[model samples]
Target: MSEVPEVRPPTVTPVRVVIALCLIAPFVAMLWVGSYARTGPEFIGIPFFYWYQMAWVLISTALTMTAYQLWQRDQRARAARKDGASK
Candidate 1:
């Protein structure tokens, strides 16, 4: 009897795409906002450029947190699959 090769399950490509977008969107938004703010006036009292960069700092933090959470979830799922396969 010939033995067939084992096939690995397909990866969650969509979820990975979503995670990448979530991580990249904020950075892209920040860049757009920065370029616009460079030519614009101060918002209320703060300088336009300064405020724009500061806003991005906060946004980047949020994006980083989201990425971390997604990575953790992915890791957990992978671990669970590994554990199941080992059983």
Candidate 2:
């Protein structure tokens, strides 16, 4: 009889935690409406509420890109490790 090896679930790593934060930050910021639902602090005639949301658009794009890059790097590292272990 051949016994099959057990497959363990992947553990949480710091890289993954950082990646999650990068992805979640924008969502958390925008969803917490009370934090930026004000009209003061105008920027060049634009209300703070308007500019803040617009700024988050760019910030979200950067964060999303960063998360994607980190994910790609993590995947490549994982693949290398898997190949090395199989050999």
Candidate 3:
């Protein structure tokens, strides 16, 4: 009888860690409202409190996209590694 090979779980990589941070940043920023709750810095009449959150919306989108791309690349690399190991 032939025995099945063991499969190991993927290890954490720097790219994955960065991707996690990118994904969590927006959530943490919004949750910590004290960080941006202010009115002194206004952008063309918009209060800092409002504008900061609005700015994060765009920044969050970019971060999310970046994290997604990194995640895809990481997945591909892992897949390739698994294929190589299996062969």
Best by TM-score: 2
Question: Which lDDT tens digits does candidate 3 get at residues 1-87?
Answer: 999877865578899899999999999999998898789788999999999999999999999999999999989988888898899
The candidate with the higher lDDT, 1 or 2, is: 2
Task: For model 1, name the residue pairs that clash.
Answer: none
* Per-residue lDDT over 1-70 for candidate 1, one digit per residue giving the tens place of the 0 to 100 score: 9965654546766667778887897778776854755635878888777887878788878877887888
lDDT of model 1, residue 65: 84
- How would you order the candidates by lDDT, starting with the best? 3, 2, 1
Give candidate 1's error at residue 11 in angstroms. Answer: 3.8
Which residue pairs collide in model 2, if any?
A: none
For TM-score, candidate 1 versus 3, the one ahead is 3
- Residue 41 in model 2: lDDT: 96
Number of the candidate with higher lDDT, 1 or 3:
3
lDDT of each: 0.75, 0.90, 0.91
Give the per-residue lDDT digits (tens) of candidate 2, residues 16-36. 999999999999999999999
Candidate 2 error regions (>4 Å): 1-9
- Give all TM-scores, in the order shown: 0.69, 0.88, 0.86
Error of 2 at 54 (Å): 0.3
